[model samples]
Target: MSSLAYGSFCATCCNLIPPETEPLACSTCAKPCCWKCAREPAESVSLFNAPAVICVACDAAMDLRGGGKMVPKPPMEQGLQRCRMHPERFLNLFCLTCQVQICCDCFVVQQDHKRHTIDSIEEVYRQKLLETVEKFREIPKRLKLVDWEAVRQVEENLKIIQEMETRILGDIRQLFQQRTAIMLNKTAEKKAVLQKTKDFVDRTEMQHRQTLESIQGLNTNDFLRLQAALNERCESILKDVGQLQVEPVRWDDIDCDLLPSCKLQPISLNLPNGDAAKEKHVQIQLIDDCGIVWTTTFFIGGQSLALEMKPNRQLDEFHFKAIVEMSHSSQIKVSGKSFSFKGFLAKNELISLPKLNSGGYLTDTGDLVMRLGIRPENILEESDLLKALLVQQRKLNSQLKVENATLKDQNFILRGDMLRVSSESQQNKETLETQVVALTRRLKMFQHNSYVHNQTLQVRPQTPISPVSQPEDDKEKLSSDMQMLRTKLDEMKTSMKAMNPFAIGSFEIYRWSKDSKFYSPQVASHVGVTIYIIVQPNFACEKSSDVNAYVCWAKGPKLRCQIFIEVVNEFEDECVREDRVFDFSKGTSFTWKSVISHYNLFRSDGFLSDDHLKIKFGVRPAVE
Candidate 1:
């Protein structure tokens, strides 16, 4: 009999085994075996592509599936445990008082736990198992809820940061635009003044060049003929040159920086151990640009929390106070520089911190952070000061414009006056030259006559010498005439000096308005007095109506004088005059009660033309 006829079998049993038996060859024992004597390989070794079957003796060396692998059982599932102190005995009882498992032998023998309460271990395990299952059932739902809330909070914080960044950028752009506009306006004003001065200088320069060319080329005979006209033109040019003088521009006039000195910045501080949420007392101090110190104290706790701020020094321009409500309230008042707000904070409602111009921020850790914002008071005051200066400068510029216009008018008048003086002087000079020529001819004739008379007296004794004595008398009269001419020339120079253009007083023309019941700010003036005229159509007087005029001597020599006020209508060639004697020692103002009646002064009578009245005043010594 062959080994194959016997089939696979257990060597020890020596009984015929089933042909389906999985046989394993033991590498260590060098023997063939069946599944009953062999085991599966561990998972670590079975992963590789190797023989599936493994014998028990070669289990550590070979790879197999679902064999030789041990599955650990939880200790709680174990039927019972031996006591720590009494290892030989099984712990069948649980001591409630000592909180330990005990063997029956130890519970009976140990003095410490002899009187403790005890229960069966199976009963205690049943109760603890139910509690653990219930706790495990709630874990998944609670974890999902926590995860959702964390993600939502993260998204909300990100959105807030984006909004703040966008808003701050927009504010910065707007601020820059405003500053740019201010600078542009200032530059435009400065340019206008400079342009006006340039135009005047150009015109004057052209006139001067023309005058110089006219004087440069001259013919002796032509010059003598046009001497009076030439002198008048030169005088007029000199008067214009004097009036065209303008002051140079100064640095102080246009010195203004429109940009803000300080910038807005974010500040933050962290409190230690959530102390801000508890009853914590915090005092914070802040200093401002004006060197003012502000202190704020926080009393946080319970249902009520108070926040108080006080300044080390009191301020007149700005007053500040703030109140924070942790609990629900209808309204709360918070003080600020320009405006005040009343509102409530619901739960954890977010609020943008107030921006203070000269104020500061108080932090939880008693640290004060000063946020530099636009100083409202300083800005307002500086704006006001600049506006005032601008207004004054504008007023001065307008006055300068008015004065320049007046000077131009005076220059024209002076030109006319100088032309008249030049004509007169030229006439005088020509007349003097003619007189000198005549006197030279007369003296030459007298010398010849005297010589003839002396020769006749010497040659013929009979001839009379009376003519010679007569010539001596005529010579004395010529000397007296020369003395008178010198005296007249001296008087003319004194008169020219007295006729100063600046010394002449001025007057202004004003129109009365019945609708507004106010004087027009647009005042018309002539050579330094204010002429307040009222057309009183409704005036009650013995006469039906009259023109009332008040004379205010604003600037002039203080002297007792009689002012002759005249209302002249040049087109109509009509005139009305009144004389008022005023003692300037008392006052420089005088009212001409009724200079003229409405009937006599109205346009119908040709006294007022084109709704215009010309007022003229002449000052003279009261004695005269």
Candidate 2:
């Protein structure tokens, strides 16, 4: 208050503060300065009373006083260094607003620093250093622990690899043994046949020579009989030898399922910058899920100019049975890029971005962030709801089978009862016929006698009434009752036949696609499952002469399925059919090759109708 200025520069920013802001003066030199340069000097830096509000020269003097806990002098603050604009004054105060050190003249004269805030540079540096040291004190200890963990993981891997190597070598040796056994069997069988043939030839020659010698001393009839016998025996033996032709190669015996595809290694990755909103070039690291300190790099940036994952090591591999999702704003949807790999995804694989469906994906900060969700595909999984449905259906089918068995048992019982009733009716009818015949014969006799009597006595005697009416009535009623019972039994048998189902369910696949190779859409029905027809339509085959079909099923509650795939002609008759009892317990696929000629399947008026192939597929529980 000793001297007042209308306006003054701030020592910090050198900006002019207008008269209304009310600038303050330095405590020592009485130099007019903005209040901003004082840094609200009346308040405490750490909830305590500040000593005083002074200029850079006063702060430097105070630093030289008794201050313990000394620190290294920075070049800018050493030896009372003068400010750039003011040569006489020292630079000890830090402009908090402008982030630079300034002297008293800069605060009193400069217009830009007029409204800036300033604080003691020493206090700010001291507080920041203490916080930094405290935060990083235990980082070294944690890092040492991490190093130990890495060592343990490497050891585990080494042990696993050793076990794997031994097992694999054993498998290879076993394969060689099996092959050797098969070769030995084939060679032994051929040697046996050759030895038998040589013995037969030698015996025949000896016999013929003996017969010739014997024939010279015998009759012509005996010689003729011996030669004829030799001719017939030689012809029959030669025919038997000719029947043993060379065996064709059996390719079906080649077991492709000997080695498993790969061990299941599941990994989940989130891609935040896949879309390349700001830069088209991007790269991401794929960490190994097996704790192998290994990583594959997927780069969209480099000269390769494609999104691909490259593994550094020869043993590195990846699999993509991935469920990819794209997120824009709050909406998330599947990218429709799920794939099924027979094995792990390997080298030179390209990745595609999840397409955005709606509005701009950029956030408030102009980052078009994309999120990717990844999951490996597994064929050994079943839908839980569908599995439950299948179980219910199976129970129902089993119940129906039980009911059918019960009906058959009842039918057999009814057949016995009907036989007994028919036999009784036959007996009754026979008895009635006998009675009627007897009565008629007796009456005829009586009539003859009566005529004789009439000649003698000249009067006709009364004939006793024949007793056949009751027996005849009983026979008619019994026959009517038997017919009614037979009708009822017939009705029951018809109902039982109708209730007995031959199969659990069936589906038909009749499809025609211009791009049949990759056009496999899912077909779902109330059968509580789905079917996907992935086709390989190759009409032109120069090397192999027929067609092949393969079907894969994700695992579920194990079942013994009898599956039949038939190629149906336009007339609804089976052109060809493949029937097999497939054990669906394993999570693997079944294949049928060379089932039908390729030409017959796709040609006009054959199996194809309107350029479409019709297949009737059926599945039933295999008979135990």
Candidate 3:
């Protein structure tokens, strides 16, 4: 910290955990920083308003949405939830177009939900709460009158209903346990009245119990308001039970039938023989088209799956206990949400096994009828898909036509350039050959000169043996080496030009006939000299129809060094190599071409693309 901001700055504001404060680290770098400096721009909805850990540099440089790796996720907000459409933005606004809560970006940035009856999230929440409360008032209003004669007429039905009552009561008891935990903060006076009101209709039918369980998850404010209103009604009417009305018998009446037709059963864990002790930890994954994965997981035997419904991987996860439910006659289901319903039946849910034996839910052949299939709603389909596709097809056709015309014009221009290059290539080829011959002649001449000079020195015995130090041998030997390299370089250039009629530079051509020559992109050698391969059909050297590729230096200073070049085939096996030693020290011998034989890479499926050939090359330093 600078002197100006030292004392005022938080200890968590920088990288490094000082002994003076607790270690708070950035989510991205894992470096310790003060909360004040490292805090993210989004407002914190943490219990204590604790800021999210993210160094300023990472927050600015990170591109989580653009497919960057090691992405640090944003912390989940408490009251204000995030928008599915835009992960960075919060759902503070309502989207009237879809009658759903949406982030500010959804209304302002996304054009689809722009024009509609927009309102604040709080406003929508309150409106929905009131609507729910109005529906809730229906239960108590009807509870005032009971048709006792209708209920008593079906004594047999009453016995069956009473049997189901015990299990239903147990489920309701557990549901209220969760509810009580939520309602503990309310006033004792209101809670006492709520208890008295609950007692009047505590033994409700299964359907009503389901409705109550669903309502138990309402917001705290809405629940409190609902409870307060219920308390008011109970105080007004519970004073005299004798005033309640009793109606006549009507056995067929839907409201009088207090029993659910659907049978409720406990889930049985069926284990294979000799594997009865095995505990299964299963997670069912639901991946959307956008690549987001939602998993509902559970465990069997010794433990229950503790699935945490966290917004992302970074923050603290809100753990929930998973429940297994038989639900229906067929498929077994699992729900990871906090609220456990009477259970939902998985109708027409097919589990993707190769085959299912023709039997009941579980076949005798042990081929269970387990299938997982995508639901229709999960798939994203455009409403006007056909029209959109047709429009896109038309645009693509027009683009192709324009490209074809442009290519034709370019072909004319290229034809002229090709003719000019051909002429230069021929001239250049001849010049290189001439230079090679001249170099070879000079090398021979230098040998003759050296021999003649030695003979002259021998004949002149009077001539001193050079002041007792070194001879002029080193310089003469170096000159011969220089000429030798130049000769080899010229020879190599001639050979390359002989293999191609289209000049040394790059040129694209289309041919229905098979091609015999290919050039790889120039790659740098370990010595920094650019190296490239010139491939030609080998009919004699390797007795193969594939190829004889030669690696050669390209457009660089000729340095004296021996390099080991290994070439591999399509399967990446070392097919050939040029590891021969170059006697540059002898100043008499050297090699330029590093040739190897391999499979036909000119095939379209191999390295040769339709109009472009892509060959990956690895660079190795020249070893002296």
Candidate 4:
């Protein structure tokens, strides 16, 4: 370290360490010197590890072993030299066998390793480096080829699988459609069967209802008599109890155990009915335990009848006949009577005649009771008989009640059967629904497989194989020969409307007649001249003449005949007149139109619109 001293006199002072305390020699010179005048020694260039020394006089360096200063030399002077045996003077080569650097002369002329390959040193180095780089560059291309080959195989397999899936799915779809159709058909058939069963049940129920109603109404008179008898017995018992000073008891409760539950037996019959129009006769005999017997004889008109009776049935072999009067109003009477044949049925009877009432209304079932002598002439006797008939009525009422209960039980069973059928139908419906769901799921899976196959086929490249395999050519031909059935379903819905009625023009009457015996002949013509208008054969036509009218013209030589009618004058003598207009435009084919005139044409009273003249037309011609 050197120190600089400063003082008030402004003179510079240098400080230096003495060698005894610290080394003050220069690093380069190794000489003790004052700080202000010290100099650095020159650098040594020796290639030896000896301590360096410098000459201060010449400022030169010397090696420790007395050698000169070191200097960096060019390659030619240090080591790079041409081979001795070759003419080349450069060393830019390699010894191939020895793998050592050499000049071109050594590479070509060295006999010991002349057969080995030799090249420029830089060229060999570059070639080895390029080879290493190229080897690394080829790896990705090889890997790509492997990947493409594997992908191609995978795609081909997928394509084949897809084709198989497509075929299978097509079959599945067809099967589903067929099954759906079958299910629908089965459902329809089941519905039809159900409807038929329902109809049967309904019909049976109606019959039961009718039977119950009939039973309820049976022997109402008998029940009344029994009630009266019961009341009389109760009254007598009450009187006896009063006499004994005892309390009256409830007879109904006391006798409840003794009273048996009544039962009913249905009636069966073999009927004897013959054709009424062909002079067939009917006879019925009713006998009671008291030997009171009744017999009836009847003659029928078609299925309808006119009947006569001997109400005094105790007579032996009574015979009677009647004047059979028939009417168009569904009313026929041997004499004035109203009767029905619905009240005379008995259980298990072989009736020899169709049941008939004195009143004449027929029933499909011949259950009519003969209510004889309903006329006012025999009212008293008929009343008495009706009264006497009430005695046996109570038994009929009990029988009817039991029958009704049995029918109700039968109806309940039928309802249970109906409910069970409905439940079965519902179960079938649910099963069908489940089947549909299963099919849907299978279809979806098939669709998914098909999609996957399609994707594979799209990505895959084709192979150059023949369509048919060599061994399967015959089998493929069979596929080609399969029958192709093309089915076309056509549905036609047709709705039909009702047709309008046919219309005809007004009626035309060519001729008419009027006589002196007629009263108010013109008014009679107006009332009786029915213009039978035909709107249609089935539809009734309006009788109004506003539709059209017609006139009647006489058909004769020179048209001299005019339509006429006879009328009475103030002198009570007969006069011929033509008063009304013979309108034809208002006439239909079935309608009639007429105008009246006198016996001669152009008579004073023969005006077409005059009164006191009658006109009529029929199929018959004018009478003489």
C-alpha RMSD values across all candidates? 51.3, 39.7, 41.2, 45.4
Task: Assess every candidate by TM-score.
Answer: 0.27, 0.26, 0.21, 0.19
Give lDDT: candidate 2, residue 246: 38
TM-score order of candidates, best first?
1, 2, 3, 4
Candidate 3 Cα errors over 4 Å, as ranges: 1-270, 273-297, 302-325, 330-515, 521-535, 538-624
Residue 51 of model 3: what lDDT? 32
Runs of candidate 4 exceeding 4 Å displacement = 1-388, 465-624
lDDT of 2 by residue, 343-371 (tens): 33333433333322134433455343333
Candidates ranked by lDDT? 1, 2, 3, 4
Distance from true location, Cα of 624 in model 2, Å? 89
State the local distance difference test value for candidate 1.
0.50
Off by over 4 Å in 2: 1-79, 104-117, 131-171, 205-624
Would you list the clashing residue pairs of candidate 1? 40-67, 40-68, 505-527, 506-527, 506-528, 506-529, 507-526, 508-525, 509-524
Model 4, span 1-624: residue lDDT tens:
111111101011223333223222223322222322223323453343554445453354422332222223323223445555543344545667887766534534456557777554445767888998898889888889999999999999999999999998998788777766766776677577657656765765675576556556759786565666655655764564344321211111122211221111111222235553446556655332223343445554444444433443332222211111221112322222333222221122212233343233333554332233212113343344445545545667778899999999999999999889868755764554455555455556555655665576667666668664333443343333321100100100000001111111122222223221222112111212322211111112221111111232222112111123323233343433332323322323332343332233222433222322223322111111
Top candidate on lDDT is: 1
Candidate 1 wrong stretches, greater than 4 Å: 1-79, 106-143, 216-624
Q: Is candidate 2 or candidate 4 better by TM-score?
A: 2
Clashes of each: 9, 16, 12, 43
- Give residue 613's error in model 1 in angstroms: 83
